[model samples]
Target: MLQQRQDVINHLAETPFWSLIKFYMDDEIVATDRKKKSGMDLIKIIQCYDSKQQKFKFGDHEPKAITSEDVVEIFGLNNQGVELPNTDKSTKNMKDSFVKAYFAKQKIGKKNDIVEAYQKLVQDKTPEGAKATASIICVHLLQSLLFATFGTYIAWSFITICGALDQISKYNWAKGVTDYLFKRINKSKKKRKNGEESATINGCIALILYWICLHTNLLETISGRENMIPAIGRWDITKIHKAIRDIRVEEIEISGRIPCVEPNESIGRGIPCSEEPTEEHSNINQEECNDIPYPEQNNESSKKKENKTTGRKRKRTEVRVEEDQSITITEA
Candidate 1:
């Protein structure tokens, strides 16, 4: 059972989709318990936004802007790929093809049907099955967290993409989300101009809140463990809500620049501040494909095991003068 578990871990480690999420999260059980949710301040912030210029015009005096670059930086999603195919007929075709290949019926049963289907596939214990499992987890993470909307139903865009999950990283997922947010932000500004009451400010609203948490000092926030990727999944919604509760949009202020909200430094008043940027703006180190930590042991024994196995490899040369051949043994 222990070895089998390691097999699953290593199998998933090599899979591209698994590597993609692990690049950001590198953890299990990222969810937090919550009694409250956040984003009142985010809604208020958007109220002051001018979509034409893509700037947050607090008044005629001070205006600060956010960009798509900021969104991609915080979320750490794929920055380049083919743009998402968004058409009714395309989604319909994807659903038809997916169900026919995987399910007994003409369509998927309901919400989470894909999850059910994924669970079944992994039961076969094949490499393909293991890869399929990783794809589902990756795709679902994108849907529920980054590109999410308010619905019990899954979007057809994601559903269609599931058919080619091996190449999932080839879709410009970050572009899809950033595009949606720009549209939503523009819609929001237009609505308030027409005296429309506060509507459902859609498309990953919490993301903007978290991004603002870095820029302003109004909200109480936590700087996560040093060097860990800023997986938005790690956010505590209730904490965000409590911090900004009872605060009006009129009182909000900007203390840090956008697209560079540093967490390592004391960048702003509330959250962690920006660094001098030793690294490039890009988050993922594409060359380092094998960063996933092995779960071969539990917390009780992991340290000793890690030191014994995962530490630096040493090269040793042995001379066999008595024989014709000299042998070299390298540490694994």
Candidate 2:
């Protein structure tokens, strides 16, 4: 029993990413901005076992304080046994595919609805219950939408590892997840050529899909679980484990600058550049400025003054005494 416990401890030490998932998360929060970086959830770590003391030492703070019960709880062991649900590669793939499909639809309302159900079903105080509820809700929602006609049994086959974080070996589970994601990327490429109608996959979608798949347990009910394509059964675990040995917590911290709003003052507030005469009149040399004549202004200013006087100096000559002989001829 002691040897087995020691082995588990050794395995955990090798895999750092598992620390984030399995540890007692005191308070995990993502940095809202650059000033405040996100913090990792502290796992209740059993530092070492003292054979002489016949107890576990949790480090300098406490000696001989940790117990087997604590270890079992941290490891998420059931009273029944050490076996975990669907920790295999194929199960991981099913979870991945379902998550991809769910997000592809991008139904925010539906996502929110499922989250609400999880919160309602699982109490906050019980992390294990919460995790399980989340896994179950995720599976149910995906099954309803993706494999509604197929039946619930089929969905279970796919999501065997759902909510097994506490019970399963973190090192192996992490490797399975990695393999599942890599395979999805390769598969998604062929599917993407058909666009959303076919592939409906992208980098952002793939990343989220992988996260959700590991966290949730969405299984498709079917007879043949072993034969599923991209099944973990098909791939060699040793190769996959070696491929991701170097991945660490630091690498997981996504370093990025949030997009800033463009300067609106220049965009909408300023007058059109075409309308504004950018060349300064003062900047031009005297000769050059003078060469640019204003014909309309010059013509208006140089109008003749005779037009004003012409109106007042109208001709006022007396009426001419011409041709008034009609009356005299009649009298004669």
Candidate 3:
């Protein structure tokens, strides 16, 4: 059961549509850093040009070497997770002196407070930082709105975009979400309920509408669309739209069926179903031998039950008889 739940989640997450969304969303951070790096490269070029100009006209002049401080001042690289070479070493003596004086001035000494204060001191001014922060806030806000308006599964489409789910937390979050969703699905199946499926249908409908918004010319070639990557425009949104269409079609088809409430009714052994009895009743009847488990039964008990119910003949094992008997018998 756990394996099935994981399989479902893996299928959903690894789908081209959701995978593309994850990649595009994660690219936001990567793109921001690229922009900052590009800016720093330009700054370095300008510095080199200025140095050459000065040397050409006014004889000897020392060329300004680009340092971490220069990069931080010009491009706010420090806040973009860029390594500042020798930062601690170069500032060690000054830091020691400042710390001594600061300790004398204040009585506070909490580690977290000090860390927070230092972080504030080096906060980024770069466009990348602004974009990353804004993107996270906007995406999470949208997720909250979607979750409030729609069901959990529908809102889960934007799970990859949630800022609170980082690399370390995503695994547990995905597992929990998968378990919750499957629990609901199974519950819906057992009670002959369609609430979960209905919500999923509605959610898919909403997602289709959302996809339409993304594909419209008004929003195309924009920052979120075009800036996703120079090579792939809009992240091949049309393909994802096709996937969404398929999901909607499947949901509609499934929802069209009438649910069967009979315990003896063939719901199709391995596969759970709602109404729409096929023309092939024999195939449906064959499901009586399926390996589905009862509420309190585990796999071994379920298998034993299936063997008893199906009454399929088991293979016989060859057994050697004693010399006196001189006869070989097969044991079943």
lDDT of 1 by residue, 1-332 (tens): 21254445564454333433454333331212222222333445566767777667653436766555555655555567798776112334524555455544524222356556655655657766665555455545554445544332345556657656555667766677767766766765566557654433445555566565656654433345222334333333333443344344444556633332346543323332322112222111111111122221011112221111122111222210101011111112
Model 1 lDDT at residue 158? 67
RMSD of each candidate? Answer: 18.2, 38.2, 29.2
Model 2: per-residue Cα lDDT over 134-183, one tens digit each: 45443332222222211112223334434343333333332333233233
Q: After aligning candidate 2 to the native by TM-score, how far in Å is the CA of 227 from where it should be?
A: 40
lDDT of 3 by residue, 1-332 (tens): 21233332343243312332333233321110000001111111121223222211111333322222322222121222212122111221223332332222433322222233323322434543333333232232222211211221112223223322222123322222222323332332333333322211111111222222233221122245543421133422222222222222212111122122343544322122222212221110011111111110000111221121211221222422111111122223
Candidates in order, TM-scores: namely: 0.60, 0.25, 0.20
The C-alpha lDDT values of all candidates are 0.44, 0.25, 0.24
Q: Is candidate 1 or candidate 3 better by TM-score?
A: 1
Can you tell me which runs of candidate 2 are displaced by over 4 Å?
Answer: 1-18, 21-117, 124-159, 163-167, 194-198, 202-332
Rank all candidate structures by their lDDT, best first, as comma-separated numbers.
1, 2, 3
Q: Using TM-score as the measure, what is the rank order of every candidate, best first? A: 1, 2, 3
1 or 2, which is superior by lDDT?
1
* Candidate with maximal lDDT: 1
